[model samples]
Target: MKVTKDIGVWTGTWLLLWSTLAYIDFFGIGGISLDTYFFILSFIVVFITCYLIAKAFYRTPLQKTNIVNYKFIKILFVIVTCIYIPILYKSLVLMTNGNIWEYRAKAFGSNDEASILFGNQNLRILYTIFIEGGVYFIQFAFLSLYLLTGKKSYLFKGFVLIFVMSIVMLGRSPIYYYALLVIFTIIYRSNGKLSLKVPILASILACVLFFLSAYRAGGEITLSYFIDKYIVGYHLYGFSLFEKSGGANSFFATSSWFGQATLGSFSYLLLYPFSKILSINFLYFNSQEYLLKNSFIVLNNGDEANAFYTIFYDMYQDFSWGAPLIYGSIFGIVYGIVYKKAMLRKDLNSFMLMLFFLNVTFGMIFRNPLATNGFVGFFFYFLLYILFNKIMKKRLHV
Candidate 1:
């Protein structure tokens, strides 16, 4: 049986992922560009090299599941979903003012929620667990339960949770996750086999939810905002600025990126949502600061730069010309290890971790996502999965 996660990993890595660099940086303005060539060539080279290397390390992915524990996951995800629904409602209805997007733009974007967010340490932790913590895991959990257990209630509740969560939070990133969910749900329905109507209906419903989310965010929806803010918002225009303003060349002089790897530039940013809870000091490392300073997009438009600390940017900051190859090979080896392990265990939890890894890798193209609360939340859940597996093996002796 196919792992189902392969879809996200492949597309997230090679197919539709890294083109944003070229799309915004050079091609946005005019003629054939050298930077465009570099970005594309690097992407192709890295993708092929990584895939081939990972292929070498692959030892038959997880084929079929023998153990049955759908009941456990069903209760787990459903409980979390139920807990989250009310918190989400309270956060929206009582916490935020005015429209959803406006409140988000003010709280997260402007960072004005610090007082409310950081008022009490215990509440902060509780809020984190309630909001970004369990909620993130439940997204995957709901789908897994639905697919594995054949429960339409789980499916309906999962989709509704996703839709309402995105609407109340005013976030658009969940669109990708929903698409991935549809793919996985279809694939797993037949126990990793594919059919037409299941996937198709899943996709149609996802789109419906997406549009409903957009509508709920504000009564306004425009192609330009969607394309520009979400799509173009992730462009690599900062590279052009780096090229135009004479190469900084300072990266080669130091091993700063090594430090960044251990604690990424935005790792603190990842913990920001939990700052009130954890009492960790986090500095603002806005991606736009570099964009407005260098890239023509910000230079001309003068809009707040929503820069994507693009993969190349982080790699370049760490290793100038060798960024792609270095990072590419590293991720290839890591991906290979996970693929091999998932193949060996053939468990749903391990498979979900693989999916999470793929999502992080793909998002790395646009932002340093590995260090975010989203990724951190997944890490803890993966740990819990490992512990749960141990407990089950020890007690149930299955």
Candidate 2:
């Protein structure tokens, strides 16, 4: 793939954006009080290693797959839409009348408790489909098809789904993720040709994000306040935590009693699904305790210092001083190989998988996406793709 389309470049770009802001401490609250020379060195080592490995694998031959049937996709879209509409309707009816942000807050128990989406046990079975499955992936599939087939209907469906989901979910991150996927799809479709619209869309996305955040904060917070508390707060808090603990002070290291009985924070991403499947809470670990305990901040009415602790903090908490080397190297290898297959070979299935993996990569500036129920969502995405591919192959053979 072209350097511009590389996943490592994409990850590095986002990491730098937030990290730079944190380092500058633009609000001058001493965001990062400790020296980060070694931390930064660790990141640099990972970045270079990952990029080189990805480039080296560019020569790998592309894998072949049967073309997906648009007819089947249209039927599948109808089915998924049917499955989700009632859920959205019930959620809207249950939520407060005026506030939009309350939807996400309620669903995930971020700031509030009356979650109409996730709180109900009967309705929780479809959480995976609601989160990263049918809703968002359908939009991605239609958008990709629109680009390839020049089908306006596909484009229209994509936008309609995006609009409804954004309004219903009221999540700024999902919107940003969709925007990133759009940009990536365009770049891949155009064979690495950089479009002028990319910058334009980014500017628009930035504005939308700011306004949404301000609205969520009750419209009393200013842009500077939002950026400082959120955009910059993640790394600032992360670095500060590292400094205070003297390295490796996460619950994993400290909570031996809990760790002996249950999995640690690092295992949360990997073991979450089985926990959900078997109804075994012990198999899964929740990072909310860690995030709340570690990332407290008082700014503009005070909160849990922004939910984004940055991947570095999570790594350091788990691996202490070795976080940089371990996480950086692992991420590098995974991203490098995935970029080689998805972006370079232009495999749509691989691209879809790449997009799913992006929940971790793009979210590195924030907390691990897998910290919550994201691992189950990723599993569903992969499972659905495999099943759909089989159906497509069978149809082609018939």
Best by lDDT: 2
Candidate no. 1 TM-score: 0.70
Best TM-score goes to which candidate?
A: 2
Over 336-392, each residue of candidate 1 has an lDDT whose tens digit, in order, gives 666666557656675565566655655654555554555565567656766776677
TM-score of 2: 0.75
List the candidate 2 regions with Cα displacement exceeding 4 Å.
1-3, 33-37, 57-59, 69-76, 94-105, 109-114, 117-122, 128-131, 143-156, 203-211, 214-295, 299-304, 372-375
In candidate 1 the C-alpha lDDT for residue 322 amounts to 66
Candidate 2 residue 244 C-alpha distance from true site, Å: 6.5
- Model 1 Cα RMSD, Å? 5.8
lDDT for each residue of candidate 2 in 1-398, tens digit (9 for 90 to 100): 34366667777776665556555656454445334535745675786586677668656676654446455456657876776687678666755565655555566553334346667543453464444456656765676575555565765576566655555566566666666777776675666887786787777877877776765665567877777665665445554443344433332444332221122333654566777899876541344336453455554224344445555655554555555666677667776777677654555566665666665666655555655343454456546667877887886789
RMSD of each: 5.8, 5.0
